[model samples]
Target chain A: MASFIDFRNPPGSDRRADNAVRATAEPRWVRRTLIGIVLGFFALFLFLPLAVVFQGALAKGSGVLIQAFTDHDILHSVQMTLVVALIAVPANTAFGIAAAWAVTRYRFTGRALLMALIDLPLWVSPVIGGLIYVLLYGRRGYFGPWLSAHDIRIIFALPGMVMATTFVTFPFVARSLIPLMQAQGVEEEEAALTLGAGGFQILRRITLPKIRWGLFYGVILCNARAMGEFGAVSVVSAKISGKTNTMPLEIERLYNDYLFPQAFAVAAALALLALLTLVLKTLTEFENARQLEASRRVTLETTIEPPSAA
Target chain B: MAHKKHVLPGFGISLGWSVTWVSLLVILPLAALAGKTAAGGWHHFWETVTDPEVVATYRVSFGISLIAALINGIFGFLAAWIFVRYEFPGRRLLEAATDLPFALPTAVAGIALTALYSPNEWIGKWLEPHGIKVAFAPLGVLIAMIFIGFPFVVRAVQPVIADLSADVEEAAACLGASRWQTIRRVILPPLLPAILTGVIMSYGRAVGEYGSIVFISGNIPFQTEITPLMIVQKLEQYDYTGAAALGFTMLAASLVIVLIGNRLQAWGNRFRKHA
Candidate 1:
């Protein structure tokens, strides 16, 4: 109990008394000093490596880094990355919202197994996912002949690359949106139906506003992962240098050829963007909590159970 | 998602849509790998998977991933602790830095780390006489794995750490417990589940990671080569059957890891319920 008061009443207050007795009397200082050393350890273990990468990236002048951005291959990579993210993220978002709604709004059989199957890609290695696409659509893939007969090129091509990315990253938004929708309570929608709000109107007016933050969070995550994907992209894309190479593939090529500065600089930009997304993620929750809580209270107020009059 | 998707008849419809998409796009390809591997017949498939190069790559990949995940587990915990417990200059920046591995293309992360730690580089020069090389070696693979893997642990543990009531620890201190004792008895026990969960996830991610590791790992067979690299090599050989064989082998191992992960998660959920 005495230790309790000393520990919690304040910090750095009574520690001096322990210090006075510490000379020749205790190695408690050693243990406490070890706690102080934790900071140094954190810097070495976590921050130092990251700092090294950052330093390597910035060692080249901004002009050089920016110039790398316009080099035709780098630009092609960037353009392809953005093009894919632009297309894939929105597609996933729409899929996510529709899927989130379905999962949360309805009750039916086979739902349990279906949820597991949806989560399958998350468990499947990205490399394996690429191989799977190859298997399904490659020259000897099950449908390869069918696809080729139609003059459809899905492997070693842009369409193939995009399809691979889309499959691997599909679940990000739906997983994010489903829980938020579930918690918002289904009763309000029931009330909306009683008032003849119609399905689409209820969604636009009610659900979209409520789940927007979650959706935003999901979309940002989806975009980041989509932009950064490598293994799946590597497998299916043929990595045709200027044509199919994205930032990640470009990084590998540059490094393979020993172009260190340029590669790090490009990577640094993507890392910076990802870091920004996480910061947004932290901000999102507080904003989401406040919005959801406010609307939830509103929902409860209108929950009069249809006012049964005998 | 704010409004109920009231139009759908049941959860089955959405689940069906999601499953069908992930299945056709994700699973069917994998199933094709299986089909192709089968095409090679058992003897040839076994030979392809167990080829010295292929097995060596898996050994290096698994070995480095295990080491990196362990290292990241320790530091990732500390980073999470700092993010949750401390307020300091650049705290938010550090928190954001942890996500670098996730956002930055793995290719970039691999390259940046390689440049920084390459033998002739700034930090490496200091350790060169002592003979530590960071780039284009097995160690570089470990370094890259650490970079791309830490975010999983940090992000997984951060929220749970934040939601942990500080009062519980305070109460332990209010008793006669030493700070260490309080942390062990009061703090670490609840944290173990989350930490373990994070560790398992990061381990799984590192096991499968290809891009970040590829640039730094030198891709030297019997040294820094990884399983994914082996798969790529097979494709390069125009030995599609061999590539399919190797890919299926790794796919099987990853599924085992995934199943183990699911079991760990289920156990954690049960423990949470009991707690």
Candidate 2:
């Protein structure tokens, strides 16, 4: 996520470079016009929808918005969304760290294949991500009859929803962490081990601090996706009112029922969450840039060794 | 760089966990779908995929998605160029806004887009007078896809554009090339792979997208119906095998797109090296 931003010029050089380009770049009128068009494009496509979410939510006044939020079904959906995130985020974070550690720290056979397998979820559609679960656990599924005999409802239940969300978000933490971890390498941990620190000690005292931001960024992404997951959850949820309906599903139900204000109210809430996620993403990215600059400066001053061969 | 040795202690534990978790959560379920898809034998699979209605759904899904991706590719490039090359008030805010599609829930996007483009809505009402129906039409599918896919293109291309050095452009200018010539000759070639990647990702995402497109498309069978929606309808009817067949088709298509993208990117890299 941090690497998504390309601050090609060092921090100190950006201003001077911007000035240099501004002096000799395209005409002011042309530049202004282009900028206006770009901004307008964003305003229409991005900002306008965002505004509509709120406008529609507030259409019936603040009282309706409150009533919508206070609706029992909507409240249950919110709780369900939180519950899903609470379970999924930590699970994925652990998996991400483990996968990143294994892939980055060791050289082995089929390593490329393992990384590719991790990326499989990224290519799989969210709809299919849900559908696969149905294929595995729905009434007609291979394990369906058995699970039903045992009275364990995996599909059309919370477990099914959690599984679908987990599957859909499986790659976020790992994807974000792998590159950062690969670049980090295992040298620091190796150094700590050489100094007689135990495995857990090195991980806790050295590695955790270094990779905490990446982990947090990945967790945020995972959490956002998990909480907002719709297509996949929709398939397995069976839309059993408050029982299986997540917030997004609730919003969809409301909209489909012509409960426009209620739908937009919930959407506004989700949109706020999205905005918060974006804010966190920006902060993490900025902090990552700062850290990268600091580390580079440190390396230049020492000039004795690089951290990792890669 | 070549892979290096490490002294990590939990390699076995971590690797084992990764394989087990991924296999259980993702691999096994997908394999089950694939297995079920083939359960009816190759002939059944062929007939399902070749069904004319299914075929038309595929065409509509991929066709509109491709167009949307292409639109994103062009506009996204321009947007990336603006973000990377210019300094202006609210630039950071607007640049951040590009990622709204990524963060916003697909359902929210679908509804917002539906409202914005419905004949009774603001933008839709204005366009309605011109016979350009958006909501409940195939055009609505394109707009929904564009709304959802715009970020992939912008995100893919922005870094490359930003990483580009000003010195190269200045050198091109000093060599008596016009700005357009400089961009065409020096800028675009390297950016092509990124653009292609973005387009492929956008296409793949749009193809599989359901939550957002479900509302906007109006789900008129054989007209505005999409593959994912068709699959859901199958699921609703308890047609597990049928749904799996459609889902498997989508999966195969995505895999092929990914493979092609990888090959093209590799080819691009080789060409760069040779040059």
Candidate 3:
């Protein structure tokens, strides 16, 4: 029942473990030399192919690169991507704040199931998410007959893209908010309620301030995921180039057609976006991971407040 | 901050809210798929689901995912081990770089891997000389899966390894146990649970993975086609029923895998406690 080996004892085969360390430690002076070697591997593995595509795009020189940015099709796709993220992220954040408040603050039937359901999108491929919409709203889909009777254009349309993106990205906001709410607990909410503040007032005055940073964090991630979403968008979009293509789908199209340069330019842009979002996520993740820290902050606030009145 | 003298139960409201979201987010989409498949009637649905090419594609995807997950599990663990046990120069950089897969778009990852390992490229050229066809082959699918899946295992195992106190390993050595024996008997047992968690997570991710695989897979029907890819293909054909049917099937299979993987994780945790 106890640990198989206690840490109280010295490490076994000190000589061998040390030897192992030494063996790996070789090229320490050569480490910087190998920095390129390792980064070369990563660059070769991660960046080079993208670079190759970018280079191919640049084959026509700076003119093509400029042309890529100004191209109507590329511009439309870029604009559409920004529009979706801008719209979806804030809407999702509002939804998430409410959902996180409800789920964490209240114990209800099917709570666990809801938690599981929220994670479903992360598990299901985005492609499936896309197809689900088509099955539901496409011409002959489940509700397709009814919706079509109403002249509703659900598939191969912008609205459809937005809806699918929303569904696929439905999890992030709530997920990000849940841990924060869970960590913060309801002491503050209770305090506000006792002060005669209504639910909405308490939420605005107390809850929002506590979790504004977390909400912002969630929004950033939701935006990143929304912007980069490919399989689902690719599936639903008509591949109408300038009309429907997001950056990801555009990259896929160019790569598929061996238009490496244009493809990589977009891919490079995506990589840059991914890098930016990653930095943001890291900052939020640091904030999120400190479960105790949030609680400690809450505790500190309460400690500084007046003791409960008679 | 609101301090409640007494708060009324808000179960109904929260429950209603949760059901609304779940219905909209998860159940509705899937139900529509199932409904569509069922609308075709069982006979037609059976025929569609059993299409030989469709079945073959499913097999290729499943088989390649298994292969890729296994490969990643092995190297992923070793990479985790090297990163955990050995602290040399550039350690933090390497550790940070391990998360590159998380940052890299799957599509970008696919192209990068394909370019690097394709038969014509510098690395792929050597691989081709060895008659190992990558890019646009099943092998390429495995490579992408491995690339994307590596981070899961490494990330999962790293924290657990860090939490392991050096005292236990020292105790094993004090018993005159060899380093290998200590690692196998003492270290490996506890690590198995975390390792299994990583493996299952990676497997699930690999199974659902699309962006990364599509590029390298060449999307060859009946060859390198993945389940998710197949769903997309079906949707492309306007075979809404078939796509939903396949999606439901994959959903069920993955759900089962996840449940079983969870049980294994629980069992592993029990072992760690008992160990």
Using lDDT, give the best candidate's number: 2
| Model 3: per-residue Cα lDDT over B13-103, one tens digit each | 5456667766875688788877887777788778877888878877766777777777666666766765655544665556656766766
Worst 10 residues of 2 chain A by lDDT: A1-10
lDDT, candidates in the order shown: 0.73, 0.84, 0.73
lDDT of 2: 0.84
Where does candidate 2 stray beyond 4 Å?
A1-24, A299-310, B1-6, B267-275
Clashing pairs in model 1, backbone N/Cα/C closer than 3 A: A132-B29, A132-B30, A207-B2, A207-B3
Chain B of candidate 3 vs. true chain B, TM: 0.88
Model 1 per-residue lDDT tens digits across residues A1-310: 1223232122334677555333212145544443454456445445665566567667777877877777899889889999888888888887787778767777656566656666766766687767777777788777889999999998888888888889778888988888888888776676677887866777787778778999998888888889989888898887777898988888777766767677777677777777687788778867888878987877666575544466
DockQ computed for model 2 against the true two-chain complex using alpha carbons: 0.56
Interface RMSD of each: 5.5, 4.0, 5.2
Cand. 3 TM to true fold: 0.86
**RMSD of model 3, in Å?**
5.1
- List residue ranges in candidate 1 displaced over 4 A: A1-11, A14-63, A292-310, B1-16, B162-175
lDDT of 1 by residue, B1-275 (tens): 36444453334545566666666665666678878888889999989877887778877777878888888777778778666655456666676556656666666666656656777775667767898877777888887777777877787677767656555665665565666676677777777777777787788888888877877777887999888887777765666777788877776777787777678767766755654
Per-model TM-score on C-alpha atoms: 0.86, 0.93, 0.86
What TM-score does each prediction get for chain A alone?
A: 0.84, 0.89, 0.80
